[model samples]
Target: MTQLKNLLGFLWYVAHKFQRDRCMQSASSLTTTTLFALVPLVTISINLFSLFPEFVKVSQAVRNFLLANMLPDSASRIIGVYMNQFSSHASQLTYAGLALLVITVFSLVITVDHTFNAIWGTAPRRSWPSRLLIYAVLILVGPLLLGLGLWGTSLVVSTSMGWAGEGAQATHSALKVLSLLILASGLALAYYKVPGRPVKGRHALLGGALAALVFELMKNGFTLFITHFSTYTLVYGAFAAFPIFLLWIHLS
Candidate 1:
């Protein structure tokens, strides 16, 4: 009972800190920024995926996984329309158009950097040149890495299926675990590196785990709400995804 009380007290303190930091305001700003950035980010990712024809299946798998996990059914169709619109135009983009896309994506990255710096109580955010270089690398490398992971998972599942007839369920469970681990690792790295000041590994790990756990619960809970009770469709009409995404970003 004492331990439970201590845990509750710690959580309350954390909630107070979060409220004092004005994270909801920052999240609102980020949601708007992300809405603008989404097309550019998707365009760039599609271009990246096009580079490796052999990983086409992996790219599709990742896309399907994300669509399944991230958006509720009511909002997914609207989100898909925008995604397809961006993807269709990616191949036709001229050099100048690509440059604009890069700038837009980087704007989102910079905003995130500022948010993390503020959370860490750091002053005078990193120079634009340095931030640009880092963000550029992340933008270019992250999707390729994700595709590779999905490809690897596919191979593992195939091999397991061939070796053991009953391995499909096990493979699916393993892949789910792998995906969670990947999410946790990315969160850990973000928490550790985004802050201007150096953060302890344990602190970063704890933060990352907490973030990932909350994200998972939120995703499931939000989906359940959408499935059973949400009247967002009626409220927002055909453009329901916009508001749903905005709310999800703030929740995240």
Candidate 2:
């Protein structure tokens, strides 16, 4: 009983610490920067995937998985239309335009760096060259790694379905679990690396686990709220994406 009480007290303290870190403020700042950066980021990502013929299918699969996980079914269609519209024009942008796009993407990266620094109470940020190099690696390498992982997972699911016949549902459940674990791992890495300071692996992992759990709850809770109680849909209609996106980010 005493151990249980101690654990509960510790959890409450961590929760309070997270609140004190001003998560809403950071999340709002990210949301704003991300909105500006979204077009360029998606454009660049799709362009990169287009370079490899094998990645085409994987990219689409990964995209579908993300949309399904991130938004409710009704909201997904609306968001998809907007994404398609932007992507149609992405290829026509000039080199100068693309450069600006890269800058906007980097702006979001810098914001993330600052937010992590604040969370960890770190100081003396990395120099510009080092920062740019690290951000470049994250921008270029991160998606490819994620794509490969999704491709491999899809392949396994498909193979399992062929052999077991009744494993499709089970495979889906397994994939959801895998996705949570991956999210946690990625968050752990970010918590460890983004502050530009040494962070304990255990501390990073704990933060990651907490973030992953909150993320899952956020998705489900948002979907439920939007489906049942959202006035944004009725009031904003096609513009519903704006408020929905903001609300989601604020909650993050």
Task: Give the candidate number with the greatest TM-score.
Answer: 1
- Per-prediction TM-score, please? 0.89, 0.87
lDDT of 1 by residue, 80-117 (tens): 77778888767888999888888889889889888888
lDDT of 2: 0.78
Query: What lDDT does candidate 2 reach at residue 120?
Result: 79
- Candidate 1, TM-score vs. the true structure? 0.89
Q: For model 2, what is the error of residue 35's alpha carbon versus the real structure, in angstroms, after optimal superposition? A: 1.3
Off by over 4 Å in 1: 124-126, 162-168
Candidate 2 minimal-lDDT segment of 10 residues: 70-79
Q: What lDDT tens digits, residue by residue, belong to model 2 across residues 1-252?
A: 999999999999989997999887788899899778865665476567767898887677556666676555655665577678777887788999888888999998889888888887877467889889988887777777776787788678767674665566766776788788878998999988778578899999998999898888888888888888877778998788777776765665
- Alpha carbon lDDT of residue 223, candidate 1? 76
Clashing pairs in 1: none
| Backbone collision tally, model 1 | 0
